[model samples]
Target: MPADQELDQELDQELDQELDQELDQELDQDPTGGYRPLVVVLLSPLAFALVFASWTIFAVLGVELKALLGFGEAHFAVLLAMPMAIGGLAALPMAALAQRIGGRRVMIACLLLICPFLWGLSHASDYHHLLLAGAGLGLGAGSLAAGLVYVSGLCPRRHAGLALGLYGAGMVGAGLSYLLLPLISQAYGWRTAPLLYLLPVLLVAALLWLFAEDREAEPDVPDPLQESPPRSPPAALLRRLACWRLWRLALVYSFFYGTFVALALWLPAYLSAQYRLPLREAALAALPFTLAVGVGQVVGGALADARDFRALRWWVSAFVLVCLFLLSYPPFVMQVQGVHGVIALHYDAPLWGFLLLLSLMGAAMGVGKGSLMRLIHRDHRDEMALVGGLALTLGGLFAALLPLVFAVGNEWVGIRTAGFMFLYASLIACMLVMVWDHASDRGARA
Candidate 1:
C-alpha cells in the first residue's frame, strides 16, 4: 500500500512538470528563431495594405465607371458597396479556416484568389464584369480576418493592442488608393489602375510564404479547463454570437467602422456632386480624412495599451457624436423679421470646413476601431478569431447597407446631407445602447 501511494505521487508530479514545460513553450518569445515574429509583425501589414488597396480601388474609379456605364445613383451605390457585402459574408468562414488550417495559409490563399479578380477588373468592359470583379475583390477584405488572427498570435497580450493597431494602419491603403488611383487613371486610363496592383499582391504573397510561421504548427499546450472538450468552429462562432456583449460591440463597430468604409467610398463622389469640384480635386480633398484615420489608429492603439478601454470608449463616442452632429447639419438659409426688411442668413460650410470636420470624425472612428478590439481581447481572448470576425462581418454588413440607404435617402429627400443624417441617427442609437449596457452592468454588480 505504501509503494502504490508513492507511485501515484510520482505520476502526478510528472504530469505537472509536462504541463509547465508546455506553458513555457507557449509563452516563449521568437519561437521561430531570431526575430521571425517581429518580421511577420512588420511585413504582414504591408501585405494587408496591398490587399486593402485592391479591395477599395473601385471607390476611386467608380465615378468614371458610373458615367461610362450610364448608371444611376442607386446602381453606383451598389457597385461601391459590392465588395463589402461579399467581404462580410466571407469574413467568418475565412477566420474560422485560419484557425484550423493556419492563418498564413489562409492569407496566402486570399492573395492568390484576389489576383485573378484584379486582372479581371482591369479588363472589364461592362457593368456585369465590374460586378463579378467587385465580388472577387471582396476576398481582399476578408483577408483581414485571417491577417488579424495571424498578427494576434505573433505578439504577447501586453503589446497585442498596439501590434494589431499598427497592422490595422494598413487601412491607410484606402488613402493610398484615393491618392494614387486618380493619378494612375488620368495617366494610363482606369483599366490600367488594377494592373498595377497585381505586382504588389504577388510580391507580398511570396514574402509571406517564405517568411511567416504558422502558429498551428506549434505544439499544443493543454489546460484542462481552457482546452477540454474543444468546440467546432461553427459551434464556437454560434456561441460567441450568443453573447449579448458581442452583439453590442457589433453594433458599435457597425457605426464606426462601417461608416468609415461607406464614407471612404462615397466622399469623392459627394464632393464632386455637392460642391461641383472636379473628380481629381475631390479625390485629393478626401486624402486628409484617410490619412487621419491611419494616424488615429496608431494613436488609439497606443492609448488602449496604456489606458482603460471603458474611458477610451466614452471619449471616442463623445467625439464621434459631436462630429457626426456637425456633419449632419445641411446648408441652410435662415430668415428673421426685422424693422427695416427681412434679415436673411445663409450658412454653408466651405470645402475646408467639410474636410476638417470629416478628418476629426475619421480620427475618432480610428481610435474607436483600435480600442474596441482591445475590449474584445479582454473579454473574449480565447475566442478572438470568432468574435473579431463577427464584429468585422457586422461592420462590413453595415458598410454594404448604409450606402444603399444613403442613395435612397438622397433620392427621396433631394439632400446630399441625407447620408450624414442617417449616420447621426445611428450614432444616437449607439449612445443609448451604450448607456443601457453600462447601467445593466452596474445593476448586475449591485
Candidate 2:
C-alpha cells in the first residue's frame, strides 16, 4: 500500500480502540445487568411521585389560602400558578446543569433545596410569605428534567417508552395531594399539610442517593458526543432548539400537559363553585382525572414500546379532541316550537358526567404525554435532557398562563365553563398543526 494509505489505516484503528474503551467505561458490567436496570425503573417512579406531590401541593392548599387571605379569583389564580411559572422558566438552566454535572446529583440537590421551602410553606403567615414559599417549592420541578435524563440513560432504547411512561405515572401524586392534603388540613390544619411533604421528599432523596447509579456508570454504551467536539451548554441548547420538530412537539405538549396542570390546579375550585359541592367532595371528584392520567401513561408507554408511534399519537389526539369538544359545551336552555305547544329543553351535565368526561380527557392527555417523551427520545436521544427541559418549560408556561386565562374568561364571560372553551380552541389549533405537518411530510416523501 502507499505510505499515505497505510498511515490513514493506522489512525482509523487507533480511533476504533479509543471508542471501544469509552463504550466499556460508560456501560454497566454487572453479572445481573438486566436486574439492576429493572430495579432503577421500578424505583424511579416512586421518587418522582414524591417529587411531583411536593411540587404541586399548592393546588390543594390554594383553596384555604384564598379564603384566609380574602383574595379575588385573579389573585388566587396568580398565587396558584406561581410555582409552575417559576419552574418552567428555570427548567432550561437546571437541565443544562444536570447535563454538565450528572442528573442524579442534580436530582438530589433539587430535592434537598425544596425541603426548606416546604417547611417554610407550613409556617407561612401571610400572602407574601406563601408566595415566597411557593416560589421555593417550584425548585422541586427541576427533579423532572433530571429524572428524565437519568431514567433515559438507564433503560435501553427499545424500552425507553415504557420506562419513561412509568416515571411519568408519578404525576398521580397530584391526585394523591387532592385526597390527602384536604384530609390532613381537616385533621391537623392547612398549615400542617406542607409539613407532611417533607417526609417523602427526604425519603426519596435518600433512596436516590443510596441506590441510583450515575448515568456514566449505569449504561455500558459510549456517549454519542465522544466523537464530536464539545460545545458550550448554551450552544448545545440553541442547537437543539434550532430543530423545528422540538418546537412543534413543545406546542403539542403545551396543549396536553399544560391543560393537565391547569386542571389540576383549577378543578377543586371549579367543582365547588359550579356544582355547589363541598370542598372535600370537589377534591374527591377531581381524583379520577389524576388517576386516569397516571394509568393512561403506563398503558401508553407500554403500547408505544410495542407498536408504531405515529398510530398511537393519532389515536390519542382524536380521543382527546372528542373529549374536549364535549367538555366545551356549556349548560344551556332551549325552546322548540311544536304543533301543539312550545317545548322547553334544559341541558346541564351532572357532576358524575362532568367527572367522567374529565377523566377520559386526562387519560388521553396522559397517553399523549408518554408518546411525546418517546418521540423526543427517538429524535433527540443525545439531547434528551435539553429537549425535555425545553418541552417541559413550554408546557409549564402554558400551565401557568392558562389559569390566569381561565380566571379572566370567567370574570368577563360569567361562565364557569369558559376555560373549557379555551381548551377546545387550543386543541383545534394543535390538530391543524398536526395535519399540516402530516401533509408536509407526505409531500416531501412523494
Candidate 3:
C-alpha cells in the first residue's frame, strides 16, 4: 500500500512538471502582450487572400482582354494559362531560396514582384505586353509555397492544422475576382480590371513586411566527430529533396490540388459548351465549387489536428470518387423496347445537379489537401520549406498539365466529359499508390 502511494505521487509530480512546461511555453510565445499571435495568425490569411486574388485575376479578365486585343483562340487560351504554368515551374527554385533565407522574405518578395506585373498589365495595349506581364505574375505561385512554410513555422503545434487550413482557405480570393471584375469592367473598362488589384497587393506586401516576421528556428548543432563542411544551398536542397516519402506526398497532393485547379479552369468552358449557357452564367455556376473547396480546407484542417488524418483522407477520396464517377459520363440517350411501344431514356445531368456534384467533389478535394498538408508538418516540421515546395511544385505542374489533358480529351478523345474522366482516372491512381504505400509500411513495421 505504501509503495503504491509512492508511485502515484511520482506520477502526479511528472504530470505537474509537464503542465508547468506548457504554461512556460505559452507565456514565452506571446511575449509581445498576446496581440502579436492574434495579429500574425489573422493577418496571414487576409494577406494571402490578396496574393491569391492577384494570381487569378486573368481568369475573370481574359474574355474581355481577348475581345479587346482581337487575339485568336490560341492566344487567348495561352494567356489564360501562362501564369499558372510559370508559377508552378518557378515554385521549386523559389522554395529553395526560401529555405536558405526565410519564408517571410520570400513572401514579401513574391507579393512585390507581382505589383509591377499588375501595373504593367493594367497599361498593356498589345498581346505581347500583356503576355509579358502575365508571365511576371506567375511569381504569385512562389508566394503560396513560401506562405505554407511561413504559417507552419509560426503556428503552435496544438493549432497547426487550423492555422494552415485558414491560410489555404484564402484561396477564396479566386471567388473575389468572379464577384468584383464584372462590376469594375462595367464602371471603368476591362483595362481597369488589372489596376483594381494594385492597391491590395501593395498593401498586403507592406503589411507582411512590417508585421509578419518569420519565427526563426534554432540552428542545428554540428556533430563533433563526423563533421564536414555544410553543403551549398542548391546542393543541400537537392540532397534533402531526394526522398521517396517526399515524392509520394507530392504525388498525393498533385492528385487532389491539381485536379481541383483543373476543374476550376475547365468548368466554365465545359458548363457553357455542354449546357449552352452564357459564359457569365457558367462562371457563376462554377463559383460554389471553389468556395466549398476553400471552406472545406478549414474544416478538414481542424479535424485532422485531433484525429487520424490517413483515415480522414481515405474517406475524402471515396466521397470524391462517387462524385467524379457520376460527373465523368457524357450526355447519353438509350432506347428500350417495351411490349407495346418504344421507350427512350436520357441521362443528361441537369445544370443544378451537375453543379451540386462538382461542389461536393471540390469539398472532398479540399479536405484531403488540408489533412495531408497538416500530416506533412506533423511528421516533417523541420523540413517544411523543402517538402512544402516540392509538393507545391508537383501540384502546380499537374495543375498546369491537366488543362492541356482536358483540351486533348475534348478535341481528340471527343468527349465533352473527358476532363472528368481524366480526373477520375488520376484519382484512382493516387488511391492505389496510397494503399500500396500503406501495405509496405505495415510490412516494415511487422
TM-scores of the candidates are 0.90, 0.88, 0.89
Ranking by lDDT: 1, 2, 3
Q: Candidate 3 residues 329-445, lDDT tens each? A: 898899999998999999989998989888888888889888888878766677887788878788777877766666676767888787778888888988999899888866775
Instruction: For residues 2-112, write the lDDT of model 1, one tens digit per residue.
Output: 465457545644654565466447656435644666767877788778877886687788789888888888888888889999988898888878877888889889999
lDDT of 2: 0.79
The lDDT for every candidate, in the order shown, is 0.80, 0.79, 0.76
Q: Evaluate residue 333 in candidate 2 and report its C-alpha lDDT on the 0 to 100 scale.
A: 99
Q: Between candidates 1 and 3, which one is better according to TM-score?
A: 1
Would you give me the overall lDDT of model 3?
A: 0.76
In candidate 1, position 292 carries an lDDT of: 87
User: How well is each residue in 1-446 modelled by candidate 2, as lDDT tens digits?
Assistant: 44654575466446545654654454546554545566678766876677677756766766677888787888878877888888888787787677777878888898899899888988888888878887887777788778877788777666778889998888888877888988999999988888888888788788778877675433446578798777886787677688777776666766777788789878888888889977788888898999999888877777776644655667788888788788877789999998999999999999889898899889888988888787777666677777788887888888888888879878978877888888888888888998898778667656
Residue 21, candidate 1: alpha-carbon lDDT: 60
After best superposition, candidate 2 residue 404: deviation in angstroms? 0.7
